[model samples]
Target: EYWWWSLFIVLAGIVLAVVDTLTGTMGMFGDSGLLGGLFELGVIVPSLALGVRRLHDINRTGWWLLLVFGFFPIAAIGGGILLVSFFLLDNFLILTVLGFAMVIGGGILGLIGIIVLIVWAIKQGDTGPNKYGPDPRMATSQ
Candidate 1:
């Protein structure tokens, strides 16, 4: 139930994004100036709602999504450190090499972070229930 709704919302958001990208009118109700704000409303809100369901399914606070997303910057910092170390070594060719490497490394870390969020979402919650509320999985049985 929740999973289906979440999927629907995500797909809808994606569709809206594509349409907005192509038409530049943001769903026939927005202009370029408003696209950014409209995108947030049309996409981010429902996505967050789905995220809430995802967290609910896992017996976690949806607030943790922020933490999970925040991992990207932390990962980028680690990459930045590696980049600085390479730069400090005074190898110009390798310095440039490290820059691209850090970009890819950061991208990989961001991907992994998103994957972790998805995995966290699908993981079965407590057998019955925990702090979040009644088990979404068990709501059907009861």
Candidate 2:
């Protein structure tokens, strides 16, 4: 159930984003466009709630979602900083090496975290609940 919901939400968001991009509207909400912004605004809370619930279903804390989502942004920001450093500190071989290491390492770790989250999302919830509340499956069964 959680997997299905997550998949649906992702697909819907993708569709909206694609539509927004293709339309090329000078939307008040910037590049996302009107529909995209509205869709994002409407779904953000529910999506986060669903993500948290899905994590809970796997006997994990909601904070795992933050870790999972944080990876990509942190990686991108680190990469951007490295790109700037490459320009400003061209003479420093060590900075370039460290920058490459951080970008690559962060990207790899982010990909691993995403894969782990997907695996957890597909797995069955803990039977009779280990933590975070009663088993959603059992709750529905009764």
Candidate 3:
């Protein structure tokens, strides 16, 4: 159930990203234009739910996922600093090209890291509960 929900969220995010590109390029947002909002909503709500389920699978409260997502800006800031450093320190065009490459490559690496985290979270948890709460996959023997 959770896996399917996560898959749905990922697919919806892709669709929304495509729609957002079209809307932005066409200047389609207005009172009548809902594609933009729909795109955002398509990504956010399911993402939140998936994040919650992911934490639950790990026997952790869903709030931790919120914290992790919220910290993304910190990583972005670090990446931006590295980019600026490359620009300021590099004298050769080749080095500048490398700098751009690092930025894009780093972004991809970061995204992969996020995917890995989510995947790890969604996988099977301990046989019983650890610390967070009940084993969501099982019911108490009673």
User: Top model by TM-score, which number?
Assistant: 2
Q: CA lDDT of 141 in candidate 2? A: 57
Tell me which residue pairs clash in candidate 3: none
Q: Which structure is stronger by lDDT: 2 or 3?
A: 2
Q: Rate the local accuracy (lDDT) of all candidates.
A: 0.67, 0.77, 0.63
lDDT tens readout by residue for model 1, 1-142: 6578777766766776676677666535544224544655676777777787767767778877776667567557656756676667555566556655666776786688688887886776677767777766664652
User: Candidate 3 residues 28-95, lDDT tens each?
Assistant: 54421356456655567766776776666666677766554544554566556566666676555565
Work out the TM-score per prediction. 0.52, 0.75, 0.49
Q: After superposition, how far is residue 83 of candidate 2 from its true place, in Å?
A: 1.9
Quality of model 2 by C-alpha lDDT: 0.77
Order candidates by TM-score, high to low: 2, 1, 3
Q: Order the candidate numbers by lDDT, best to worst.
A: 2, 1, 3
Each model's RMSD to truth, in Å? 6.3, 3.3, 6.3
Clashes of each: 0, 0, 0
Writing each residue's lDDT as its tens digit, candidate 2 over 51-119 gives 888889878898987887777786777777677777777636776666677777778988898899888
